[model samples]
Target: MATGTVEHVKFRNRDMYWDIAADLHFPPGFDESKTYPAIVVAHPIGSCKEQTSGNVYAPALAEAGNVVIAFDASFQGASGGEPRFLEDPAQRVQDFSRVVDYLVTLPYVDADRIGVLGICGGGGYTLAAAKTEKRFKVVASVTGANFGRLQREMAGQNGGVIQALSTIGQQRTAEARGEQSAVNGFLPETAEAAKQTGDIDIIEAFEYYRTDRGQAEHGCVLFEAAHGTAVLGWDAFYLAEELLDQPLLIVIGDKDKQGAFGAYRDGHEIYERAASADKTLLEIDGASHYDLYDRPNGAGEALKTIVPFFNDKL
Candidate 1:
């Protein structure tokens, strides 16, 4: 059901000295002689371009008559980076602007009409990136999560923050002393195991990322344990009330089970705090957090608003 052509491409993440793997979806009847508005889609934490970002949103947006690029983060997927699966918040935020830098260099892309759409953790970084990176004239997020808050809360639930920090500090010291760095798994090994935990979020996440439903080899659910300190200290919405002036749209599932991941609360908080003159907070009833990732009822319903928002803003 695609109405566009997709091209595999690679671009340099200048700051990180790595090449980012990306998929560009060009609208039907794309003409290089003519310029088009572009959108950069950021994937979730521990995810790659092939998941929701490229598989769902990118093509949908392209079919709506825009150019969209979904790229792997510097340290994940097909992109180049060291200490694989290191989820550094600062680099994640910079990846959006780095994508914009690539888009502007293309003769077919309108530099002034570029925008960004992020899913889950990517949504949090998109908002943070758009705050100072003014190249993105419009910004949108689906099931956006503030990773710092999510990590801190999860740490508090598993153990005290002090204990979590102590563990991370010890691991870092050990790694610096020529020991192998520890890695953390994002979810259980299988859907059945995830279901046994009785956490709806983990259960659905496993159904999506760990199974054929949305699995890709590059979408591994692991991260370096030593990178926890960066994630813990980062805040996606830091100073959003002061600097986030771009037109913004935030979409979240009304049925999101708010436990360790609080995209529901994060969506509303950013909507309330963003200083943009044009901002909207959309709550999709009957949808869960993972539902918006690839489900027809979730992502399909979201595109109803998303397509028009980009059309009007970009």
Candidate 2:
């Protein structure tokens, strides 16, 4: 596989440890005199920088005259975090912001022109980062999820907010009493089952991430079944207004039913409602959730819109 320069890097804050592994891509005939804009590509949950989605998106952004840095989230992939397998939405957002901090220190990067692109859960993180960090001048969320909505549905009507909290409390109590907390969240494992979600992209996601097309790098995410942290955790909507001052781009596949693109619709609405006058939403017809991962046409469609979005805003 073709690769970029793998930099073993560290970014520190008193409260957290970030073991950042990034592949920096600068196109051929790179120039040092000019400072390039940057796109920090965030991997989906349970994913690493090597996944095809990240692989394609980062390089594509680089090829389009921007610098790209794709890195793993703190707890998963080759990144560092304790109590392994613990995933928190708030921390994930912080991870993205920290990446911005790291990027600003680089001489070749135009700190004022930084942007972020998140796929799947990464998309949500991208929104969260934009909401919280003023440094991200432009932000994009691809086939994303609204974790709050996801939690509400997963908990079910019978298990309301109180019930959900109670259940997680019980699990934590059990863990405190020497019992191990079991992780329960997972994507459909089979192609047929994935298709049954009424999402063609989900089925394709099953084919790519579950198979060799993207599987060699990392395993799928472990569902937080007991606590449903995605819901109980921080809400991106809480910080939505902060992003109003910046440019935002949201890309969704019309056929994506796996919730990535669907979630983008909500995010787009939020951005539209924001006072920021520089936001654009593009919905690609016939594209599914997985299509944006690596296929030339799908990725092509995304870049066609994305390159121009960044070009105008960045």
Per-candidate TM equals: 0.96, 0.87
TM-score result, candidate 1: 0.96
What stretches of model 2 exceed 4 Å from their correct place?
Answer: 1-10, 31-34, 192-202, 224-227, 257-261
What residue runs in model 1 are displaced by over 4 Å at the alpha carbon?
Answer: 157-159, 257-259
* Alpha carbon lDDT at 276, candidate 2: 62
RMSD per candidate (Å) reads: 1.7, 3.0
Per-candidate local distance difference test: 0.90, 0.71
lDDT of 1 by residue, 1-314 (tens): 24668999998845657898999999988888999999999999999999999999999999988999999998899998888999999888888888898899999999999999999999998999999999999999999999998988888864677688888999999999999988899898876899898876888998998778998999887998986888887799999999999999999998885645799999999999999999999999988889999997799899999999999999
lDDT of 1: 0.90
